[model samples]
Target: MSPVRRQHVILRVVAKLLIPYILLFALYVQFHGDYGPGGGFQAGVIFGAAFVLYGLIFGLERAKAAAPPRIIEILVSLGVLLFAGVGVASMFKGGNFLDYGVLEHDPLAGQHLGILVIELGVGITVTAAMITLYFYFAGRGRA
Candidate 1:
């Protein structure tokens, strides 16, 4: 194969290998939300950024092949639904919207669960939305 195509293949292999670790770190951030700044928003961006970087380095077509728009759309909606669902649950449970303390018999546990869920939702939304935008911009750039 040509040097340019060979380089693409090499870069793709490296990116695929690193993608898993990046995703793992994002999960770690999601889980660590109970203690630190490494919560949903940061985690989501961090997660999406890896893929975006992959696209930039390899090709937008490769990125889109990796993460299609349909998938991103579904993920974005899921995140919003998850957030609203938790809020509605809190409302029904006699607390303000998103007050997770109502989720369990132990209000503190409920709070922790609620925070984790909502933080996850936030992370998903941020990641999906950012990815979708990245795709659009990258696609435009390609044109």
Candidate 2:
């Protein structure tokens, strides 16, 4: 099927309207995760879903233009590095790997910061991976 044929006025309008709300919720989940059940994984999925929805309604090329492949690849790597760097930083602080207690002068603050950083890294990686997967699958049959 031609990519242009996928565009429908209603679908595009709905998607455009919903995408912001979805992203807003994703941010909420990411930030509120510390006190609730939601976290990086859920937030990432939600964020990715918005883009995937855009692709489904708009087109893969447009989606790709919105999140270029090179930028996505960098994000994937950067996320992993951020996660690992946190662990390594803890080690340097004379704490065990993944030790959040050493991240700040106050143990509680340190733990909170560590968790935030870790979750952010995870969210980034998951978001990039999901978008990458969508691109690959969507591109499969295209000429």
lDDT of each: 0.87, 0.90
Report the Cα lDDT for residue 113, model 2.
Answer: 96
Q: Write the per-residue lDDT of candidate 1 for residues 1-143, one digit (tens) a residue.
A: 23575567777788779988998988898889779769999999988988887777767777888898899999999998999999999999899998888899999999999988999899999999999999888788547
Clashes in model 1: which pairs?
A: none
Candidate 1 off by > 4 Å: 1-5, 8-14
Root-mean-square deviation per candidate: 2.4, 1.8
| lDDT of each residue in 80-138, candidate 2, tens digit only | 89999999999999899999999899989999999999999999999999999998888
Clashing pairs in 2: none
Instruction: Report lDDT (Cα) of residue 64, candidate 2.
Output: 88
- The estimated TM-scores of all candidates read 0.85, 0.93
Best candidate according to TM-score: 2
